[model samples]
Target: MNITVHRPGELSAVDRAAWTALQSRAHLHGSPGLANPFLSPEFTLAIGHERRGVRIAVAREDGEPAGFLPFQRSATGVGRAIGLGISDCQGLVHRPGFDWNARELLRACGLSLWEFDHLVSGQAPFEAHASATFASPVIDLDQGYDTYLRHLRERSPKFIKGTLAKERRLSRDHGAVRYVHDERDPAVLTTLMGWKSAQYRRTGRSDRFAHPWIVRLLRRLFHTRADSFAGVLSVLYAADVPIAAHFGLRSERIHTCWFPAYDPAFAKYSPGLIMHLGMAEGAAADGIAHIDLGRGQKVYKDSLKTRELMVSEGWVALRHPVAFGHRARRAPVRALRNTVQTRPELFEPADKLLKRMGRIRSRGGE
Candidate 1:
């Protein structure tokens, strides 16, 4: 087995092609964080330039490529996967039955620990799970949107009816129903950034929108046509005005929902929900299978999901005193998150209070 670390220009065309060819059926595997075309050359370059504590490597066994791992090695001997927060998916991309044994992989990568949040199920074994997140909603778009609606009628009657009714009202009251599939309009993107940043601030989280690298990365992703992480910006318009928009990444087949927003002006019409329904319809028409909504179990996600998939996340450690202590403190918090994730009723009070607080903050700002 030959394990080699690769820089942007260092990777041969064949290596790059073979590496990308191995992307799994899952939508997360196609995200720019793991499989983006921009990630190949530019991402490697940026990581080197910024020295944001990360490294890239590809492992090959018997002349057949085996795995690709992206990690950031902290000074204290902790190596974390790159773009964990920003990435909607995590893990090495390799052949079928890749056999991911977390400890062995960590040892191979020469790291003491590997951490992730939005990890794919059954990928790795982790210690000290930080949280259990929501299951992403998806629609299999192999058949036309109408066919999908049929499935929903049999499976999720209430959800389909409610969303469709709201969509009709939105169009009738607002204006004509219109949609811009793959709308690359920069103005819309800018608006979404503003809203997402506001959401971050109102919740007391660090504002990722303010980071120059992230901003540039998002813009870079918008224009990239490479196979790794092709940006898909879908929009819905009413009367020639965009009412709802979704920014996400796609492989040839899978569309992964990342960020979605709608005009507050048409909030009463549930423009975002309508847009999602339309997008789901479109995905089926486009021969796509799953539209990964990312992790989180919101009321909306639960309504849309066909089923649930459990994701495992935590860390493998080199075992330092401070790191051990950090994990210990996080243990209880993670348990709480897991309990809340498994039982929505238990988490509702806190979630509702937080949302209400956020609304109050937004109102105060206004």
Candidate 2:
């Protein structure tokens, strides 16, 4: 096998086609996770246009492209999954049975360390390096929306019933409720970002939209049109005013839920939950078989998810000073966070503390 590195934009037409074909084959071979839009070449290309240091490593067997690894390299030679914090699914898009040494791949890309949080399953080369693994919730819609709804009703009848009731009440008190599965208006996207940013600040998390590149990236993706990858903006409105919205990426068979937020003024109506249900219905109708909710535990996810997918988190590093130093500096903090996240007793207290800190921070800013 031979490996070559290139900028995401540098791939030739033939190379791009080969890369996409490999992804399709992987998806068809029972690795449906490869069908995620975040793992598509279009996403990597978009990130390359918005951010620096984006690169793709193409591996060839007998002069034919067999695998692709899209990543970003920092000046310190540390590599990260393309779009890192924002990308929900991360891994090499390789043909079935194609394998490479993790350290060799990193070296070829001139990277001393490679880090990923949501590394997809079936990545055997990177599995041993993962320090932890987490369950990513998913909604299976292979049998279509009605079947999914029946399952949901059986699992959490009250939750679905109450949410639908609130939806009806929301319409009655406001106006007719409407859902747009592919909202194209740019202004609506701006509104959604504002709500998401405020939500981040309220929860003591770093606001992703504050970064210019991420904002530009989302805006660019909003207009992206492709057979395998596209940005989907779904909205829930009452009285023709937007109450809840989500911006996520979708492939032909999978929709990866990303940013979701709602107007706090309508919080009493549970507009977010209503919006999610609308998204599920629309996705299923569009022929999408699964909705990946990403690797985080939330009440809404627990209520809606049909099953879970395992994703690993850790760094693959070469035995070098930079690698050792980076691990030493990051390991303890990661350990503490993992401990808190894995244990509910610690997680709840930590969450409360963060909210308190958020309130203080918000006040100080005001």
- The best candidate in terms of lDDT: 2
Candidate 2, 201-299: lDDT as tens digits: 888888888899899999999999888789999999999999999999998889988999999999999999999999999999999989999999999
Instruction: Report the Cα lDDT for residue 196, model 2.
Output: 96
Candidate 2 — what's its lDDT? Answer: 0.92
Stretches of candidate 1 exceeding 4 Å from the true structure? 7-10, 24-51, 124-134, 200-207, 320-326, 340-346, 363-366
- The C-alpha local distance difference test score for the whole of candidate 1 amounts to 0.66
Clashing pairs in 2: none
TM-score (C-alpha) between model 2 and the true structure: 0.98
| TM-score of every candidate | 0.83, 0.98
How high is the CA lDDT of each candidate model?
0.66, 0.92
